[model samples]
Target: MLNCHDATFLLSQRLERDLSVTERANLRLHVTICRGCTNFERQLPTLGKAARAFASHDPGAEDSSS
Candidate 1:
């Protein structure tokens, strides 16, 4: 039984990283019952894509992976 706060945090993490089995299970359960969190989960990819596009167009942004 995850609360909205915990669920939302995990949702963000899920976008950027792989969730463990436990985390995936908990997130699935929470999103199944919570409409707001479900909507948030659905929107994550679009937001991530927008961020990447924005960064790609910025001339001063440093690539930190190297």
Candidate 2:
């Protein structure tokens, strides 16, 4: 029964690993009935993977080349 805004907010926090078990359960319940939220949830793992990849890359490894 969570609104889109709240679901998205919780999802963002969940991505940051800041959500508690209760929050996660609530989000799960919300996504189950909401296609938009379900789609949003599906994107999280990909986003998380991209974030981890970005974080793992060495900043100094970038080279300025023509």
Candidate 3:
């Protein structure tokens, strides 16, 4: 069983790199039983999308709008 801290770390790492089967299994199980982690996992995609959108925005583009 993964502690909340470990589970959260794994969840974030998964976005950056691939996890082993065991790691994926553990994270999946943990999130299913933990409400907080589950919500955190659910928000991962939204967070990623927001990050990508922000990264795609250029300072020059913003300056041009003014």
Candidate 4:
């Protein structure tokens, strides 16, 4: 059984690298039983996109509009 902290950590790590077979299995099982973690997992993609957008944003680009 995975705790919420461990589960969330795994969920975030998954986006950065591949999880081992056991890790995937454990996370899958944890997500099935934990609605909070499940929602967090679902939001990962949107969060990733937002992070990329923020990272790629240039302050100069905004200034160009003025």
Estimate candidate 3's alpha-carbon lDDT, on a 0 to 1 scale: 0.93
All candidates: TM-score: 0.71, 0.59, 0.72, 0.81
Q: Is 2 or 4 the stronger prediction by TM-score? A: 4
- Provide backbone clash counts, one per model: 0, 0, 0, 0
lDDT of 2: 0.84
lDDT of 4 at 47: 93
Could you give candidate 2's per-residue lDDT for residues 2-63 as a string of tens digits?
78889988988875677888887888888889999889878988988898899999876676
User: lDDT of candidate 4 vs native?
Assistant: 0.95
Report the number of the highest-TM-score candidate. 4
lDDT of 3 by residue, 1-66 (tens): 999999999999998899999999999999989999998888989999999999998879668757
lDDT of 4 at 64: 83
Candidate 2 has a TM-score of: 0.59
lDDT of each: 0.89, 0.84, 0.93, 0.95
**Ranking 2 against 3 by TM-score, winner:** 3
